[model samples]
Target: MTEIVFTPIGTVHSPFSDPRDMPIQPVGARGVRGTIELDPACAAGLQDLAGFSRIIVLYHFHRSNGYSLEVVPFLDKTPRGVFATRAPRRPNAIGISMLRLIAVDGATLTVEDVDILDGTPVLDIKPYVPAFDAYPDERAGWLTTTSGAARTMRSDDRFC
Candidate 1:
């Protein structure tokens, strides 16, 4: 067996103190503002990061307590494998989102369209280049019909 660990490089500050009724995804959180208060020791890493218009944030799902092999995702009535849905309860409890970058001041990052919770620990940050990250023709699998629902769906206690 092997063990892996990660230390957060920063903490995300957002309006969401509670998970219930929050936007389920970035599309649903359009215009929502947030910031990352990065650890001062990592401030030097921000060099050249401001040039990116969008950044991919990788954070920990700190509030999620445990794992479930299957779950009834907030968007669907049928049960789905944990890996297929973006349910927070998982083996690793990691989360990722693409946020619109507004500015970078020292170790602080201003971002928008954030669906993450306040005080969430940010594990990593990466520039979001559409040429490498986007898949215009990707399949939606079980969410084919309900894909657009994310634009308005809110979070609930289903995964909690």
Candidate 2:
């Protein structure tokens, strides 16, 4: 096996200090605002990033504990493989969110619908182009059975 390393380019500041009891997904966090303060060395990468209406955020799940290959997800009772659900506990401990870009100034970025915890380490950011990210006609697997749950589900101790 080989090891790969990544340096956090920035920190995310949000309303929730604790991971539990917060929105489990961006939909549940609709309108929740936050800021990403990029390290001075990485500020220049923000160029042209403001044009996108939405952006994909990749960050480390700093608070998540060790993971199991199968576990019960927040939206359902069944124990599914880790890869099948958006549960935080994973081998990589990396989380992703689609947030609405509100504004950008120097090394700071204003975004809304942030489901990530404050002080989380951001790995990367990418423009949310529907043509490349959205798949409306594809199946959502177990998500279909738990329809609309993400819009209301809140985090608990299940994965903490």
Leading candidate by lDDT: 1
Count of clashes in candidate 2: 0
Q: Candidate 2 residues 6-123, lDDT tens each?
A: 9999999999998889999999999999999999898889899988999999999998889999989999899999999888999999999999999999999999999999999999
How many clashes in each candidate?
Answer: 0, 0
Model 2 compared with the native: what TM-score? 0.97
User: What's the CA error at residue 130 for candidate 1, in Å?
Assistant: 0.7
Q: Candidate 1: minimum summed lDDT over ten consecutive residues — where?
A: 151-160
Query: How high is the CA lDDT of each candidate model?
Result: 0.94, 0.93
Candidate 1: stretches off by over 4 Å: none
By summed lDDT, the worst window of 10 consecutive residues in model 2 runs over 144-153
Q: TM-scores for all candidates? A: 0.98, 0.97
C-alpha lDDT of residue 157 in model 1: 81
